[model samples]
Target: MSGKKCKHCGSSEIEVDPARGDAVCTNCGSVLEDNIIVSEVEFQENAHGGSSAIGQFVSAESKGGASGFGRAYVGIGQESREVTLRKAREGITALCQQLRLNQQCIDIACNFFKMALSRHLTIGRPANLTQAACVYMTCRTEGTAHLLIDISDALQICCYQLGRIYFKLSRKLCINIPPTGKCFFLYHKVANERAAT
Candidate 1:
């Protein structure tokens, strides 16, 4: 019942509902204000015989606790590891699709990328390079007909750069890629001979 007058009926009589956190005008039956802050402080008893505030200010978009809110915002700083992994997965998927690779190949490529992330091999490296390397590794391990040059062409990057990442990733992961077959060598030799002619 403060001296605040209601704009609807100019009535000075207003009742504040603490439970609903609102103020209403009694004379005109109009809601004056809502979401009013109440001075009541709530607390909970802890196992240590201490009292603490009842609830915390949880952000609706934060996925920190068990409340299952949502993903937290990165907010004007370096991206988090999860964000980087997500981007890498997307990039790897796109590159695999561009190569017309099958689902199994895509899945294996994603797994390779995940393993690299788990081992922290992707740190301080371009995400696309890591993605391309993972895809190339998948192609090799899955025995797909794709070459490193195909991935490099799809990503529009230098083959040497992709090759460096590919070799580094293979060595770090201890993956033993199969050597080129005799037919592949003969084909390459014939192609080179034709070009020389």
Candidate 2:
């Protein structure tokens, strides 16, 4: 819409992806999916605005009221009390090690990638359901042991839709998200349900 160029490869072919809520570069094929899941924090504000305590509080409170306030307060208040980038980078270092990613360059890369994904994935979106789907896919691809129900319920969407969205988003992001270690957990739950029938 803004006729912007690609940030990754500098291509001039850019458009907004409704599914991911990101501005994508079709030419060089940059996914640019950072902004999709940002509402999860509920208290994060960019330099340009649109996310703030007052705005997020109204939306979050509407979702679950006090519980939402508690969550937002925890997120934002925790951010305010921290040393900021120093601690964040340390955590990122640990995450990189766990994922076998390059600790040296992965922090900023991961931040940029996640931020882009959060922005793009949630465009014209209502809930953090897409974010949950993305996290499930991330866990699956990363082989983490987190369960799908844990992911789906946390995101407030059904498992089937989560799976569909995950694959669809993966295709859009040009990323491969293998079923996570918890994939077996989901399969087992399904098996149990079928057995009851």
Candidate 3:
């Protein structure tokens, strides 16, 4: 099933609750169902007052729970939702440190990044460099505008180092991040579409 967006936060944090037959937003604890779907899909007004919350999806597959995205390792495993969420939060926080993103944005971005990478990469634990690249690419795609130089500085490496990271991640993930100019074109296309009726 497709991932549902959150009604309150306009985040794609919705997950299906089999018991309730409704999709619930894990980010803001919002229940999105029925007629609320229309408003939920609308762009939420934030300080930026734009479509900052891109229409994306968050599925159980993204979290390695199902849809055959990634397999959970038992070296450290949990059977409860609380523990899993805590672990995910912690991992995301560390990844944010690497990517220079704030905590709140990191969780959601990481969710999407992992899913996209899993859809293309081979089965294996990605290296730190690969993870850093995925995080950087994600931030760029999500409109963070953080420069690669700034990201490299935060990672305590040269700008070229992160470029290498991005390249290696692209190789490992088997997904090519389009050129910046191409990405700009695609972004404008989406923006224009959003601007039109």
Candidate 4:
């Protein structure tokens, strides 16, 4: 502590939450300071010799790194694109969770979304719709019990557009994921769980 004390309560007891970048007075439970700027760069050599803060901190998502979940790309629109991509990813992840999918299925749906982006399939489409369509496609390909109309209702995506994009994506990607068999869709609950119980 740089001999700095909380101005609110004049207390030395202060806490810093690095994740949220907030410094608070523990005694008064008041915010001492918010948004502490953490510079991304560790060191940099300017046009000369002295070290500077010009290079970025290489996150632990590189190959052979500890974070096997990898990094989520937010794309390159500064703030707007980052927010939009994050929302899309959240939508896909949430929908997969609702479907009671495993991590592998969620990963597959995320990949489908990424593939759609790379294929420029998102150019004239709503991001949310594309995101849900990706998850729906993954469930179909994996032969899960998710139905198209059900996914459409849950995600609030238009059924016709969703089906259209799904078929086009399948054709373009050469993915022949047949629609799930009717027997699998007979129940609205977890099929195997219900059977076992």
Candidate 5:
């Protein structure tokens, strides 16, 4: 391939015929080599690493999936599990700041996160929605007080769907938390006083 010329016509157009083991000159139809052996390299690694021929390098999703927080642990490596937990904690802190919640409310919500995740509450749901539900649920448990509609508005979610997810998460966690303030006086009565206190 590197400027191989035929001596008969001094032509640089030479083609390799592997089956016949001959290098034929495309220009003058002359045989340059009667026999040739093809050489290949040895050793291969990093299958599916998604890199170039020289080396292998794999990347990860920054926010979701197995790489970071907002990912439901369907089963992943220890590194990703730690990352997910850290991300969830950061998300809870951010949501608390948005809702103007106190540290007590944040702690209460953070406590329920593991239980909810362990119960597969976020299996088919967005992790942010589940995190928002935790914050809303904590507000309901503590005296902070926010209606489902208020939470939906803050979370930019539909009230009905948020309420359903909240209920399902509560039931799965086997919690009997009582609602406080204006929310309690409206629809559902306080379920458990001890759980709330």
Candidate 6:
């Protein structure tokens, strides 16, 4: 494409076949390029005369798909755990951004969520509750000037419910979070004053 011409016939008309991994010159009927690498997924014809994809779509964040945590196939109208986790992660990120938390806090919250997921603690629990608890844990551990009530208000959930989940998540994860101190409040006040100016 960058001023390339066929050596055999000096023709610039070329056709690329990604599936065959070759580029052919249209005018001269000669191979212009070969042994090209393709990243696309291959497909095959099924017995029912329909084309089916050859592989499953695995996410970079998913460690469970290849580890046999569960089957890769999901029935119709159902979703895989990886999809659920991805959605939960997006929700966590959105909530953190809305609260104007730093990236470190968001990363820590996602890590906590993953840990809770691996431990099977998220079973029988609401996804939003788990997400809120993870963010609260991040705030506590990272010494961020955010409170459970603040997170509850952002999520529009009851503060009591969020508090219960936060305590339970911390206990289950064996994380001993320090109580909110006067320095944290002062830090928030100073940060707000600086931002105002």
Best prediction by TM-score: 6
**Model 3 alpha-carbon drift over 4 Å, by segment:** 1-91, 95-104, 116-126, 168-197
TM-score of 4: 0.52
Top lDDT prediction, candidate number: 6
Per-residue lDDT of 13-94 in model 5, one digit per residue for the tens? 8897543446889998878874443443223345786432221111253332222222223332345545556677888888
lDDT of 6 by residue, 28-49 (tens): 8998765454458788787999
Q: What ranges in model 4 sit over 4 Å off?
A: 1-85, 185-197
Q: Ranking under TM-score, best-scoring first?
A: 6, 1, 5, 4, 3, 2
Error of 3 at 104 (Å): 5.7
Poorest 10 consecutive residues of model 2 by lDDT? 54-63
Candidate 6 TM-score to native: 0.57
Deviation of model 1 at 1, angstroms: 38
Which digits, one per residue and each the tens of the lDDT, describe model 2 over residues 16-81? 643243567888777764333234432445699757543222233233333332333335444322
Q: Please identify which of the two predictions, 1 or 2, would achieve the higher lDDT against the true structure.
A: 1
Q: Which segments of model 6 are wrong by more than 4 Å?
A: 1-79, 182-197
Rank by lDDT (best first): 6, 1, 4, 5, 3, 2
lDDT of 4 by residue, 93-149 (tens): 888887788888888888887777767777787876788778878888887777788
Model 4 CA lDDT for position 197: 94
- lDDT of every model, 2 decimals: 0.76, 0.51, 0.53, 0.69, 0.67, 0.79
Model 3: residue 45 alpha-carbon error in angstroms: 56
TM-score of each: 0.55, 0.34, 0.36, 0.52, 0.52, 0.57
Relative to the true structure, candidate 2 reaches a TM of 0.34
The 10 consecutive residues of candidate 1 with the worst lDDT sum are 64-73
lDDT of 3 by residue, 98-192 (tens): 65577666765456446544465413533444445656776665666455665566656567766876665556555545456666556666765
Error in Å for residue 166 of model 6: 0.7
Of the candidates numbered 1 and 2, which has the greater TM-score value? 1
